[model samples]
Target: MNNLKYSICFISFFFLFLMSMMSMMFMIYFIMNNMVIFLEWEVITLNSMNIVMSVLLDWMSLLFMMFVLLISSVVIFYSKSYMSSEINLSRFIILVLLFVFSMMLLIISPNIISILLGWDGLGLVSYCLVIYYQNLKSYNAGMLTALSNRIGDVLILMVISWMMNYGSWNYIFYLDFMNNDLVMMMISFMIIMAAMTKSAQIPFSSWLPAAMAAPTPVSALVHSSTLVTAGVYLLIRFNILLIQSNFLKILLLLSGLTMFMAGIAANYEFDLKKIIALSTLSQLGLMMSILSMGFPDLAFFHLLTHAMFKALLFMCAGVIIHMMNNMQDIRFMGGISFYIPFTSLCMNISNMALCGIPFLAGFYSKDLILEMTSFSNLNLLIFMLYYLSTGLTMFYSFRLTMYLMVNDCNLLSVFNLFDEDYTMLKSMFILLFMSIVSGSFLSWLMFNYPYMIYLPFNMKMMVIYVSLLGGFMGYIISTMKIYSVNKFLVTYNLSNFLSLMWFMPYLSTYGLNYYFLNFGHNLLKNIDLGWSEVYSGLGMFNVIKKYSMMYSVYQMSNFKIYLFSFFLWMMIILIMLLIGL
Candidate 1:
């Protein structure tokens, strides 16, 4: 009976996903006819302070919605089998449905408030799913992710409050008000902070690696495709505002630092999942840096290609881990190609794509980013940092692939090659197809007459050759086991510095909390504690004495006690009012 209910819920969610995609597709067609001018709708609604429900479609949003639907469908189907063996199947299905519903809402939100609502919902449901294992470490990781995301959400809320105070809560209002440089800069900074935290940039990134404790399918879903991508989607959605802000340079710097730092961390990890987790951060940093250059089209292209390859890597890794009895550390994996040829081949294809080998998806997207950086007005030092990080990306991509598949003395002896469940292999093959084909399809679409000029870089033979050399150099270095202490010193410390940058935002948050606490204390100082005295008169002494040993540590002077008593009374009143008492 419970299984029947779970099946019904799953089917319902599947139907909703289809309906949402169809609606978005209709919007795309409507926009192509020029029936909807998004800019005009934004301006008109700005002048009239009314919330508009009209769909104003654009290429980027449409593309993002398409990927969202694709990833969600795959995840939902994968979850059916992944969860079937669990006892609490109904609860798991509900959480999965909630995640999909929230993602759809996020993709379609037309305003900042609606976007934030969806963002918060997605974060909340993702946390629940991460802790679905109901173990200590999973719960800890979920709590940490929740705490960091909550900080970001509150920052966004503050930005919204600032916008509302300035009378610009809609995109139309932003068009009118963005001319004020100060307001635009502040909003841009806040939005970037929200994006960085959500995308697991720098210090906030530890939670992502920790999240590998989740079920393999959940990792494939949240880490590879949907939830983390929301950050990049938000940045793309507000590209116009970002372009106007002076913060683009800062965004570029942060992205470079994040990429270099995460690349170093990836090198130090032995766990296969954690290596991929760190690589995701580095790759995302690369994408964000590219987007920071005001090229939405290139950024989205990279995003699309990255999704394909990253998903393939994670799913194939899952298959291997499952085959080997859930052993994920690379130290215990070796010569896997001999046993699971199909899985190894799929991983190698993804590895080549990830490292940007010539003619692959990564070569197309990453080479464009590198070429764009060369033309930017950014300092040469910054450019070199990104260049060096790209080399590291190639290095670790080779390290992960070789350490698992190649026949070496250090390789584990007891590796298994077969995936008993064909479901996993089928998912892997689908991703493999996408990884190989997406780049050419996108290149064809954008290189045609109408959009040709918008193509940022020439996909020439020279660029491909250089990228392939970089990747091959990395592979050779890994295979030869070259030990360079100088490389270690520079890269490792850079990562620490980037990780330390997270403290700035955290310190800001702490100061804000302290100020609010102080203000609350001051506001409650004049309140009387007469009710507290009354309650204390009724056997309260006996109650206190019963726990005197524990209460002793909390005891304070008479004035402090009076302040605490007054604050307690005020809280009770506030709670009463909030609950409509």
Candidate 2:
């Protein structure tokens, strides 16, 4: 009976999601018809179409929305069974529905304000789900994640303010703000900061691995389908801004750094979920780097393909973890391929897609990224870093897979091998099917279709061979336990260094806090704690300070003074009005 209830809820939520997608499609069709005259406001000076406001509806937005719907639906299906045993299953379902709806709204939002509203909604729901465990540790992780994302939100709000002051909030008004160099620069930087935070770039990324405190379904949903992809989607939405600021070069550099750092971090992680988490960051960085080169189509292609394979991998990991009674550390897992052939096989296929093996989904998208790097006259050092990061991806991907399935001597024996849940297996099968086929179809649609879609440059045989060699060498090194060479290579140390630098900005914020506190204390010492002295000089103030009941009242009233004072009231009202608008 409980199973039936769960199934009913899952199916109902999925149906609503489908309806939402259909509605969005219908809206897109209508919007496209009036694309050239969709004015921000119908001016009253002349109620005529002559004052037309042009809005462009290219294939890129359509493609992004399609992928968003596809991944959201799959996540809902996967989570149905993955979260079945949890006590708050109903609450989980509600959050999942809200997440899908928010993502859909974000993707098709025609104006910046609508986009931000959807973005904040998605961020809030993600925070709630992350802390679903309700433990101290999970709660802390959720708080940190929310804090990092709020910083991004602040940056986005600044951009919105710039837009309001110059261009209309509608994206079609980009041209109007293009001439204002200072505002354009500010907007560009803010958008990039938001993307970095959303996508879990470097220092802002620790929250991702911490987020593994949530259920596997939540990890799969947030990592592959909805939350992190919001950053990439933002880049696609603001492609015009990227092109205008020549910010692509800076983005490319950051993406390369993030990719390299994440790949190295994945190697040090023993937790199965953390390994996948770091890999997600690396893959996202690669896709963002490709997009930064002005190839939105390539980025979208990779994003779609990555979602399929990564979701499959996470589902397979969930099965293994469930069978092991929630043991997540990879060191405790080995030689289970024979026990769970279905999962092992699915994992292998997904791993192939992840590592960009030829003829797999990852191969097509990764090849496009590599091809782009080869053709562009980017700095040779930057190109080398990109290539090496790709190699590292192969190493860590197969290293985890090999540890689980291949190393017989290291196998962690399974006592209850047949204890697999039917619903979980069913979800895994669905993901496996999609992981195998989605890539080729997306590639064909992007490159071979009769559209104005752009393709990155093709690589020659030599470049392909070198990339293959690098991938193979990485795998060989991982297998042979070649630590000495790896140590000398400095990739690991470099990753740590870069991560430290990436985190410097955050650390500096704390440093500033420390400095201010110390400075305030010093100033107080120089003033001889004058406030206390003043209270001591006045008999009534001194009596109140010494009296326990009076001190309690003072403490209680402190909060009121902090919040309800005249200046604070004005600030609160101003903020409320801004948000309301």
Candidate 3:
């Protein structure tokens, strides 16, 4: 059985790698030749209109598929080592493969029906993965994740039903029709909402962190590339419709706030995996906001680059977590660089890449995004969100670094920590290389010409200045002072509110749920058992029984009085007859 599982993992890794290479080749061909292939198979005809299943093969789709495959390939390989102790290793591997397949289906399809299939697949498989540990936290997290994504699934279903007016579900073909028709554009709103829920933006953002209850390998895959990015990818495909729509502005505001919110929240987070998860959420916001600003390409660029490094970061964290005996608190982790230098080095590199350090994978995409933001004629709110979020990214990244690398060892004097797992290192090395180089490689390959930007020197350097300031603040804040009072205690409530993702989880879970459940309980008490009983069957039966009993007693006690009354009535009638005569 063990040998069979190993073979399954190996076969999956090889198959994914092969597919990735093929996807890249196709992506390049499609790009060079400026080509797209659309294949449609007619499923049925109604009212002289065809319902067809369609596949869209183009540069963008192929490129995204390539990245997804590459990441999944390495992730599956990484899991072989990371999940080695698990009894159901083969099942886990198969679930990951199914997830990648779903994503691929989503990437290639032009029809909303096909998209729904893949979208639902992702949600279902992810729930399985999240609840894999069979614990309360995992179960709760899985429920949140599944139900949150189900919102998107429902919205897509609505979109499909609405699209029926056009006699087709191929969204790519009818984007223009929907763009011109006001009533049709309502689908765009639903689409945006669906995407937001899937991406976990703003009000729907609680599930992303909750999802960290999954295995680290799943986190590395889902948070970084496949699951979360599906929403961004969907929007990217629909960018043409959004570019001219008024709803894009709303998306921009929400995405910016999401970016800012996640950034601030991460600074207050202590769980190592959750910090990275929040960072993923922040970057997702960046992608979404940029896409909303009418640059799907930049969003796509950042999405790809982010997938590389963020996956590496999670893999590194998994190694650390594994070594730390499942301890995810950064407070308990400090100065293990000496023990596991390779893992530490990889983590630092991924963290720096996350901070958008110069010339690294992130810089190539992140710097471009900020420059584009500066160039665009956006409002002050959005402008501040962009820069402030950038600084907070650095702040949290450095704080994390200090806690994990710079500070004194907080663990016991003796512990075994080493980077000797060659399988894990090999997988990390693939992502580590990609994390360093994928940004520049993709930028050069994807863009034939550079964007023109004329910015003042101060504005151009704003990212650097903020990054340095954030780094300084992060270092200072993480530093412990024995004599100093705890600031978090002084501002306890405020800290809790901010740290707990603005109580979003409660709002999404218990807040709304409590009210709804309370309403049901009230109905049970008042209507089902209270007023309903009084007005209907049981209460009415009691009333009728009481009245019947009262009449029976009156008849039984007053028989003689009744006879006398009858005789008096007859006598009065006879006297009236005589008078008439």
Query: Which one is best on lDDT?
Result: 3
Q: Any idea how many clashes model 2 has?
A: 0
TM-score comparison, 1 vs 2, better candidate: 2
Which candidate order results from sorting by lDDT in descending order? 3, 2, 1
Better of 1 and 3 by TM-score: 3
Error of 1 at 272 (Å): 1.2
TM-score of each predicted structure versus truth:
0.76, 0.78, 0.89
What would the per-residue lDDT of candidate 3 be over residues 305-358, giving only the tens digit for each residue? 999999999999999998888889898899988888888889999999999999
lDDT string for model 1 (109-219, tens) is 556776777789978988888888888988877887788788779878977787775664564346444655676678778988898888877656656777777777677
Candidate 1's TM-score reads: 0.76
Considering only N, C-alpha and C atoms within 3 Å, which residue pairs clash in candidate 2?
A: none
List the candidates ranked by TM-score, beginning with the highest. 3, 2, 1
Q: Which digits, one per residue and each the tens of the lDDT, describe model 2 over residues 478-517?
A: 5675545546666776656543444543463465457898
Best-matching candidate per TM-score? 3
List the candidate 1 regions with Cα displacement exceeding 4 Å: 1-55, 166-168, 408-417, 446-581
347 Cα displacement, candidate 1 (Å): 1.5
Report the candidate with higher TM-score, 2 versus 3: 3
